[model samples]
Target: MEVTPLINYINRIVTLTPEEEIILSEYVVYRQYLKDQYILQQGDVCKHANFIVKGCAKTFHADNNGQEHIIMFSVEDWWASDMGSFITQTPADYNVQCIENTELIQFNHETIEELYAKIPKLERCFRQITERALVSSLKRIVRNFSKTAKERYIIFKENYPEIEQRIPQYMLASYLGISKEFLSKIKSQLAKETKS
Candidate 1:
């Protein structure tokens, strides 16, 4: 399997020599899922931290009424996991599903621990990844509380223009915590503004 994305992502956080990359390869597993296939499900333990190689996935939770509330989206070169579940070896509160045919490289808890032991520098790299994920989560929570729906939609579009092209409008609406009709209106207004 192609590993350029994973290599480049790691290189961004920490330098990796050829030997170090070989060590990392030992712990990484590749998987492919079709669109709509689940990488994880609510109440199931999340065993791996998944790095997207070629597609997209979303993390979401279903309420008691069975309505899904999207938590986040991960596209190519991004990572996603219920880190709490992966680290604690407990059931996940959220589900991660492929939004398109996807290729991913994943490292399970045991493999990660082994990697850390074998490659001390990896611990620092992984820590940075965790920290960034936490900061992004906090930012999203703050934005949800403070921003208007239209403002949030605008931010989403700016951050994930390619994602908007790939995902269904209804899914995008769910991610933005708005109804499909409202998202439609917002898109129409933005389109008109751009045309003028």
Candidate 2:
């Protein structure tokens, strides 16, 4: 399979040599998951850094009441990992579950470190990615703290319209801090307003 987007995404920050690309391709494993399958689970150490090729996955926490609160959704070309756990080699407190049938490219930490040695530019690309992810995480926290459910839903729709279309309503509700019923009402309201 061609990995043009992965290459292009990396190339945006750093150009890799042919040999570096060869190393990357050799170490990277492609995987597919059906909806609701777990890519990672709480208490498991994240072994691979996953890059989405297509579809969506969410990282979430389950409470004692058996309710899941979604922290983030990773879509096509997005990178996903429990960053603290991945970097610290500690147990993860969240799960990464597929929202749709998905394809991903995963590389082990060690393999990635090897790539860093071979292609310093790759480190720069990954560093930038980490910075972006951090900013997104901070923004999510701010939204949770300051925005009402409807406002959060509106922002999510504006920012990730494609992801909104792909994921189920219940999951989106979980992510938006609203009950499914509330989200349905919001959806109906938005639809009615749009029709006018």
Candidate 3:
């Protein structure tokens, strides 16, 4: 029932009245998930939009060969959901799994609709959130095509310094679209360059 973090996150994008805050608290359901737990799985309809109050999660798609291609990572104060599925209420193409013990404030389709009806500002806040996510995804796609592996690795480290220490190296490598060995080499090369 802790909702301060959720309230604070929303306030950053749009100011909410005290009454609206209370309404939001009522609409959201707080949930905890253990590490490696799947909040969502491929082929299942995403029932809720989850806001991370704490911990980390990875959103990825499993290929036919069963290899997971990471789409993104979410940590404290971030949001995690299969947007396509959540909005459309269709089968999800990606899986959202917790990388650490996670606390989330979730809003289901009905509750969110009701909340939006009750507080019109919330709809605008969510729209902005979705737009930002879309922009970030587009940027990642551009980087993957235009940048070298080492360049992408450096950018990842720069953007997600907190995430680097939390997840395994292999997962990080997967996110960078490179092999673990290659990432190690890049790190070693960078280390040598820094030492010289």
Candidate 4:
């Protein structure tokens, strides 16, 4: 499988020599999953850090009432894993499921550790990626508390216009922490305002 996308992504964060790139590629594994397949299921240890080559996935948690609350959505060029579980080798609280047929480049814990030892710069690259993900998560939390549902919807649309078309309305609503009906109302209101 081609790993150019993963290599390019890593290169953007940290320059890698050709030999280092070859080593990195050798350490990673490629896998594909069909739509609705689970990449990381709740209560299972997340064994690999997955980098999307193509496709969409959502990480979410199901509550006692059996409602799924989406934590995040990832697409091509994005990394999808339960970070805590992957790092700690513990059972995951969230499930990462494919929204569409997906292709991924994965690094198991041991392989990643060996890569870090062989190509020390990889540690820096992954650290930056982790920090960015953490910042994005924090920002989303702040937005959830501070922004109105309509405002959140507008932001979501602006940031992920492509994703909006791919996912179901109910799933989008779940991501925005609102009801499907409320999202429809918000859309209608926005449309009426746009026309006036």
Count of clashing residue pairs in every prediction:
0, 0, 0, 0
- TM-score-sorted candidate list, best first: 3, 4, 1, 2
**Candidates 1 and 4: which is better by TM-score?**
4
Residue 3 local lDDT, model 1: 74
Q: What tens-digit string does per-residue lDDT give for candidate 2 at 1-99?
A: 657668777877778787777777877788899988999998899988999998789999998898899989999899767888888889998899988
* Regions of candidate 1 where Cα sits further than 4 Å from its true position: none
Angstrom error at residue 184, model 2: 1.8
Off by over 4 Å in 3: none
| lDDT tens readout by residue for model 1, 1-196 | 6677898899998999999888888789999999999999999999899999999999999999999899889999888788889989999999999999999999988778788998899899989988999999899999999999989999998988888888888888999999999999998999999999
Worst ten in a row by lDDT for model 2: 1-10
Each model's lDDT: 0.91, 0.86, 0.95, 0.95
Worst ten in a row by lDDT for model 3? 107-116
Q: Per-residue lDDT for 9-114 in model 4, tens only?
A: 9989999999998998889999999999999999999999999999999999999899999988999999999999999999999999999999999999867888
- Model 3: per-residue lDDT, tens digit, 48-167? 999999999999999999999998899999989999999999999999999999999999886788889999999999999999999998999999999999999999899889899999
- lDDT, candidate 3, residue 181? 98
Worst 10 residues of 1 by lDDT: 1-10
How close to the true structure is residue 6 of candidate 4, measured as C-alpha lDDT?
97
| Candidate 3 C-alpha error for residue 188, in Å | 0.4
Per-residue error at 174 for model 3, in Å?
0.5
Clashing pairs in 3: none
**Deviation from native of the Cα of residue 185 in model 2, angstroms:** 2.2
